[model samples]
Target: MILKTYRWSFVVTAVGLVLAALYGLSAHLGIFQAIALVLILSVLEISLSFDNAVVNATILERMSDFWRKIFLSVGIIIAVFGMRLIFPIVLVSVTAGLGPIEVVQLALKGGNPEDPGTYGYELNQAHPTIAAFGGMFLLMLFLNFIFGEKEHHWLGPVERALEKVGKLEYVQVIVAGAVLLVVAETFATDHGRTVLASGLAGVVTYLLVNGLGELFNVEEHLDHGEHPEGAEAEASGSEGRKGPTGAAKATGKAAFFLFLYLEVLDASFSFDGVIGAFAITSDPVIIAIGLGVGAMYIRSMTVHLVEEGTLAQYPYLENGALWAIGALATILLLSIEIHIPEVVTGLIGLAFIVASLISSIRYNRAHPEAAHVETEATAQAG
Candidate 1:
């Protein structure tokens, strides 16, 4: 069953290896060396992205099977090509005023020899803008989760206090805005305008995507005539009478928005991995193949988590992932002024996840009733 569920992951891994080997041969890199590099990159990507998988599973569990399939299939393509390859190339081309062909040539040629104008070099130069955008988006994500009202709390008192404060309208947005302004002022003095613009763009993107998703969800609920017990239903039954076809259509629409949100979330997570890849190699092709392999595994892990109902079993896991996201966002913003090692980022996230898992296990042992309640909730949600 495990293999059947993750067959696509295995297939992608196989194809990625074959492509990596071919690319290495074409580039005159030894086959073994290329394979080794791919392995290393794959491990690195998985290590950095385990929290990503946990967070993704939380959302994926709510999606339909059709959408989940699309995430595993088409989503992988976007993750690999759009993020691992095209994104870097486009960033360089646009920022450096180089044509697509020239950018490609520069990428293939690796770092610049005489001037710091190669694709990788130019891409690195654009890191501040990328960090601002991704950092803001991730910050919003973390804030929304922590500030929102939730029944289950990993850090009971702290979460309860935050949830109370979350009663303020748009508290997450307000906090995120304040953080962006503070970071831009303190750290982005040299490129304050650019950072501010990018951060605002990030906030806008998050709001637009999340708003659309909620709109679709509300529409779906209306179509189903589902409302709270005390709330009155819409008088016009036609809106809810569309039947199965309407329900399917509504689901598809909601799924599309969910897919978009997931893609953007993945992109935000990829900023670090993509930038960090440069430390391993300047060759764009190698970076794509290696990181692509790792991305595939992350997708596989997401499906695995959803299929296993891991989150339901370990209730605090999602909280852990969100906390890690908070840390990562802080690091991304801080990176503008100070150098933070990628390993440090990865370890911080891992620490949160591990701690949450241990806390969950202990909680379950102490309160078996909570486990039973979680199982029932999982069943209903499924």
Candidate 2:
């Protein structure tokens, strides 16, 4: 089912070099090098992002069809350019006087590894801090998703509060103001202000896009056909379409918040990749090319997961995503205070996600009957 829809993308991507040389955007990278970098990084990023894709699918499953399309196109843009391209430059500029353009030039020049200062910057020197920050940050997020009980605010107290606030004309403005204040205080460092600014911009973007979308009733177009209660029951007794109007709208809200949260998560994830890529060479061009390609694959994978309902089919993927989030969060904090290697943190996270995916697949194959039972129960609730 998934393959049928995105088959063209897959096929064109498989041709690889021909496509990259034709469409690759980086100015500094050679044509052949760009092709090779895109192919390599795309595969790696896709593989690593499977868990993330699955998690995104769960939330997106409930979104209206129109919003899903927008999410796919816009979300990918944000992921590759916002996180991969712009983020590394932000990091380098803050910590050192290195301009992003200069870094890319250095990366393209390419120097010997043993001769440390030849490129004037080494991604390796930055990895330890990236790892330290990424690891701890992801750990905290994992715990929050798995053990931290969410209050289903829309269903309970949160809903009540929102209802009360909704009557106020300035509620949204107040919230936006508060968010800006918090951002200002949190990202006060000379070097990190850019990251903070970018993050804040993302938040504002999400709110405006989604809030206006909701106000204009964009999702109303996606309402499914209604059937007479008894007639519909006779035609489809077992399978039921869930997530009605209110639920779908609520899910849209959730997606907006989730996107905002994940951008921050993506920034943290990039910290290690950006710095680590430099270790390979201080050439910002290579780092950008490699990471940009990887990010493209990640974006593609995220859309695939959303389209396929992977998370609903395999719940354990959520657990893996939770862990990945935690690991990145940890890396964020550690980068400021200590140093750790990106390789170590990335490997640990890779292992957990792979194991969880394997386990989920195995369990489903072995106990198809049990899976059916659970699906039936959920259907009945809907």
Candidate 3:
């Protein structure tokens, strides 16, 4: 039964191992070594990203079925391809105009394409732009946590003004464009411009992602007053119209946005992992397989968390996710200027996730009422 419960994960892992083994065979790597690398990376990614999965699960659990599938499939694509593949290549191209293949070869040859053992991982210089990206990412996350709608009940005066402007539709776009233009003009020389641009980008991204969700019919199973639970009949009666089932609405436009936001966060969290993995090995093939395998499992696990309603059952886990986000954001920012150990960041983030999971288990045990559906389902089936 436990195997059945985790069957999809087991299957995906097995498939990844097989693929990794095949790749290793073609590359003349020892079979055991290749499989070992795959397994190690998989475990490492999963361990490091437990908190991310939990936070994602919370939002995912609320999304509709269609959106959940998209989250799993599309999320993996964006994660593996966008971050691990495209980003590094883009960085290399911008800095050196080296073809991505050549860059990968350079990374493999130990800091020089011509010398395989010359540099090891520590000697390679990460592009300078990475610093800006990391710094802005961390700052935005810090501000988001402090100023988020969920954390702060009121939007305050600024958000209120923005909200009023947002109500004008075209006005919001004009504001976003104007903000971008201003940032572009000043970002080169002024710290304040960079901060403002970063914040604006983050907020605009959030709104765009959510708006897309609303358009996609991705619904959340949230009890937000707009579609309050148990008030459906009254809503229908008063409106003289049919209302969607909570589950049915969970995957509409809202789910699409949720998926987008989750993917963005996942990519942000993976910046360190991608760079750190290069330290382990410069083999692009190896890095791709190893990190790709682990990311797949995390994505699957996130889906399981949603299906299980783990977040709704234990809200504190949300705090764990937020904590992990903050930690990753800080780590990313710091990585720009300093080379912090990936293990340190991974352990800290992993510890929070594990703690949150343990707390959730305790909470569930103490309040068995949360498991009512599982109990009743089992009893009826029995």
Candidate 4:
């Protein structure tokens, strides 16, 4: 059953290994060395992206299967080629005032890669603005979750405090705006205009995409009492008159937006992090094949979690992922001015997720048939 669930990932692994081997033979690199490189990079990618997969699983479980399929297929292409290979090239083009074709040509030829004319050098310089956009979006993701989700408290006092503060309308927006301002003023003195603009774009993009998805999401509307009890019966009757077609249409729209959100989220994660992959090797082909294999597995892991109801079993997992996202956002915002190691970022996120999983296991063992009545503090005390 486990093999069945992850069969596609295995297929991708095999294909990547074969390509890695061919590249190695052509380049006169030892087969063992090439295989090792592929394996190492793939592991690195999965480790860095595990939290991402968990968070994605939460959102993806809500989407329709058709959309889910599209995510695995089309989304993989976007992630592997578009974001990983082409996005940075485009960034370099814009930054260097050269055509993207010229950027690609520079990357493929033998030259001083560190030269300003080369893709490698210019691509390194393009990270700050992308970080600004990604950081703000992730920050908003974390803030919105901790504030609005009052029922579940993962970290005793912090979650409770945020929930209370969230009672005020648009509190998340206000806090996010303040954070954006602080990052711009404190960290982005050199390129404040571009950073500020990118950050603002992230905020607005999140609002539009997330809002549309939520607006169309029936469960979300029901959970938040978008339709009052007095009018619920009327709405149900009206919906009944319209039949399943009406609800289905709304669901499809929601799924489409949800798919968009996932794509953006993937880009945000990749923009700041994938560049770090270059440190392992300057060979773009190896980076692409290795990371592509890892990405394929992450997508598979997400689907397996949804299909197997892992999130339901370990409810605190999502909370941990959000906390990690918050940490990542802070790091990204700070990283614009200073160097933050990728391993440090990955470790921080991994620690939160692992701690949350341990907490969940403890709660499950204590409660047997766990009720939502338990709190993290009480579980620890018990």
Best by TM-score: 1
RMSD of each: 4.1, 8.9, 7.4, 5.9
lDDT of each: 0.83, 0.51, 0.58, 0.77
**What stretches of model 1 exceed 4 Å from their correct place?**
112-115, 228-250, 376-382
> Which candidate, 1 or 4, would have the higher TM-score against the true structure?
1
Cα deviation at 292, candidate 2, in Å, is 2.8
lDDT of model 2 at residue 32? Answer: 76
Candidate 3 local lDDT, 1-382, one digit each (tens)? 4454356567767877888788778878767888887777777677777676776766665555567677667777777777766676666654565666765665555343234333223223442245344434433443444334342212247544544544553553454345444444654344445444554565556556656665554233243333434255335333321112122344444555667778776766666666676556656666666777778777777766655545555545665666666677656544544568878988888776667667767766876985565445323322
TM-score of each: 0.92, 0.59, 0.69, 0.86
Residues 4-101 of candidate 4: C-alpha lDDT, one tens digit per residue:
76888899899889989998888777677778778877887888888899999888866666777898999999888987777877787887788877
Give the worst 10-residue stretch by lDDT in candidate 4: 240-249
lDDT of 2 by residue, 220-338 (tens): 32333323232343344323333321133223544565555455555555555665554444444444555655654555566566544455455466666666665555444445435
| Superposition error at 327 for model 1 (Å) | 0.4
Candidate 1, residue 370: lDDT: 80
Residue runs of model 3 more than 4 Å from their true location after superposition: 1-8, 104-204, 210-252, 357-382
Clashing pairs in 4: none
